[model samples]
Target: VIDIFNNFALGICEGQQLDMDFESKTSVSREEYLRMIELKTSVLLKGALQIGAVLGGANEKDIENIGEFGRCLGLAFQLQDDLLDTYGNVDVFGKNIGGDIVAGKKTILTIETISLLGLKAEIFVELLQNKTLSRYTKVNDVIKIYDQVGVKQIAEALIEEYFKRAYDSLMKISVPDERKVVLIEIAQNLMNRQN
Candidate 1:
């Protein structure tokens, strides 16, 4: 059990990678983003809860439920990140900021835009890649691609799924209320912030 638990524990990062795939703005679609998020973030979050319950001596059934709960929670956390990266202020981002969505390469928003824009995307990419182009144009052209493809709505939907998944995970855990209180607070405080 511990071995399975360990493998799953590390597997959690897979979902994060999937989310990264979306954010990278490569060539993803809205549905594709969902699949990645579910696999990467949801699975790992679920695995973590199950691992905890197993170590805590919870029953098998409860472990399974807790795993689901964890998955949902993870989804929520991830979605919140997605939102911040898109709409949050660049000033707060600390480093170079445009909300990850602006880069319009492989991010969830980019995927949506590319799907809609089609071949024009090639020209867009060329302009985006141009060393001579100003950063403002790069951002502008990329956002144009997003607008062409309906990225904003698509990203919004994806964000909602992660939040729902988080709630599902929270509901399934078997731990006492006290044990969960801190976790809930963490979810509330950390899930959507830019820091």
Candidate 2:
């Protein structure tokens, strides 16, 4: 348990460093972003599950399954958060939309759009880099580019992929199907969440 906690702490520190480093970077790969999130978000969730499984006296295989499930869930959750930052309703999501856009956060949407647009991405990049643009205009413009490149659909597809992997991991646990109901319900709710 102590070791799990220590590992989680170290992973979080490293992930945060990577996240900060990516901010000024001109290029960031999808894999690198995924790895950063895995360390930043997934490791904490995985540690919690692993500690719980250990306390519950689960076998090593069951612990491993739980860890995988937690890791994937964390990834999907963070992706959903990124999507909500731009697309969610302010009333429902309890925050102003387009925070990520205004801050020039390199979410999956922007990263993929950069890759897909190539030379065409210059306009999009310019919009983000412009210091004088109004917040609403910048966000709306960036969102337009995102729509043109189908970035939302791409992000949704990736989120679904992670959720599916989480489900698979949950199913592999040794517990009976009935015992997995709560976890399944929670995951389903998370997948469908709007806020």
The candidate that wins on TM-score is 2
Error of 2 at 132 (Å): 0.9
lDDT of 2 by residue, 71-188 (tens): 9999999999999999999999998999988898889888999999998878878888887999998989899898999999999999999999999999999989999999999999
TM accuracy, model 1: 0.70
By lDDT, the best candidate is 2
Candidate 1, run of 10 with poorest lDDT = 96-105
Query: Candidate 1: misplaced stretches above 4 Å?
Result: 9-26, 31-44, 99-105, 118-120, 127-131, 147-150, 174-179
Q: Distance from true position, residue 16, model 1, in Å? A: 8.3
